[model samples]
Target: MVSKILIFMLWFLVWLLLSWPPRISSFITGALVSAFVSFMTMDILVKDRPSGRSPLRYLWFVYYIIIFLWECLKANIDVAWRVLHPKLPIRPATIKIRTDLKSDIGLTFLANSITLTPGTTTIDVDKQNGYIYIHVLFLKEGCPDHDMRLPVVSKFERILKKVFE
Candidate 1:
């Protein structure tokens, strides 16, 4: 029940922030619509409900996202430099990695994160078997290897663990 209320409030807040109201009526109408939509969709839409997250945990998640963005930016520059250089330093390979997370949402987040990164893209997810197939733009010696132990785990997985585990 509490989650439902939070979902509605969050949706309303997002709507209010994104929409500019020239008049009070529009503002009220938008908020009401957002609330109604969230209320109706909450049960059906939300797949994972992470338990026992403190306020500090959310801060950690934000910090991780910031760090990830910076890393991604650096990767983008490196990839672009390689692309424009005359050598055309390119090596493409596919990597398969196993994930310990046992939920659909976790796997989806991991796959999306790989795709969002500059040099990697998620090709397929075998959810039942808990594996991810990723295509990497640059792989030396035609071998794709990523250390998936701790910090090397996809950044989104870390947050999803906090949110869903």
Candidate 2:
């Protein structure tokens, strides 16, 4: 019951933020939609609610958002530089990397983080083996043993493991 309310509030907040300067009609419509969606999906959305009941996890999620935004900014700059330079430095390759995160939420977060980063996209995920195939725009040459755990994935995964797992 508490989880349902939280989900509804979160959905309403997102709708309000996205629809800034919310009018009375929009507010009522958003509230109704958010309530219906939250009530319907509360079970799946909050399946692991007990594990994430701690307030500390919410704080960590906020911190993760901050760090993720910074990383995204850096990635954008890097990609822009590569695009503007005369000599394109992008060495695109699809590499398979493994993750230790066990939960579906954790894996989804990690995959989304990878895709959100400017230079990388998650191609596919092998859930059974915990392997994610990612296509990267820039790959340094001769670094055959280069760490596949990109900063974005590693850092976000660490925080998400704490938050979800």
- Which candidate number has the best lDDT? 2
Q: Each candidate's TM vs. the true structure?
A: 0.79, 0.80
CA error at residue 61 for candidate 2, angstroms: 1.1
Model 1 residue 39 lDDT?
72
Count clashing residue pairs in model 1. Answer: 1
Model 2 TM-score (2 dp): 0.80
lDDT of 1 by residue, 49-148 (tens): 5666676766766766786687678778978898899989888777787777787755776666677666788888787877877787876552433553
Q: What's model 1's lDDT at 42?
A: 83
C-alpha lDDT of residue 62 in model 1: 75
Clashes of 2: 0
What stretches of model 2 exceed 4 Å from their correct place?
14-33, 48-53, 141-148
State each model's CA lDDT, in order. 0.71, 0.83
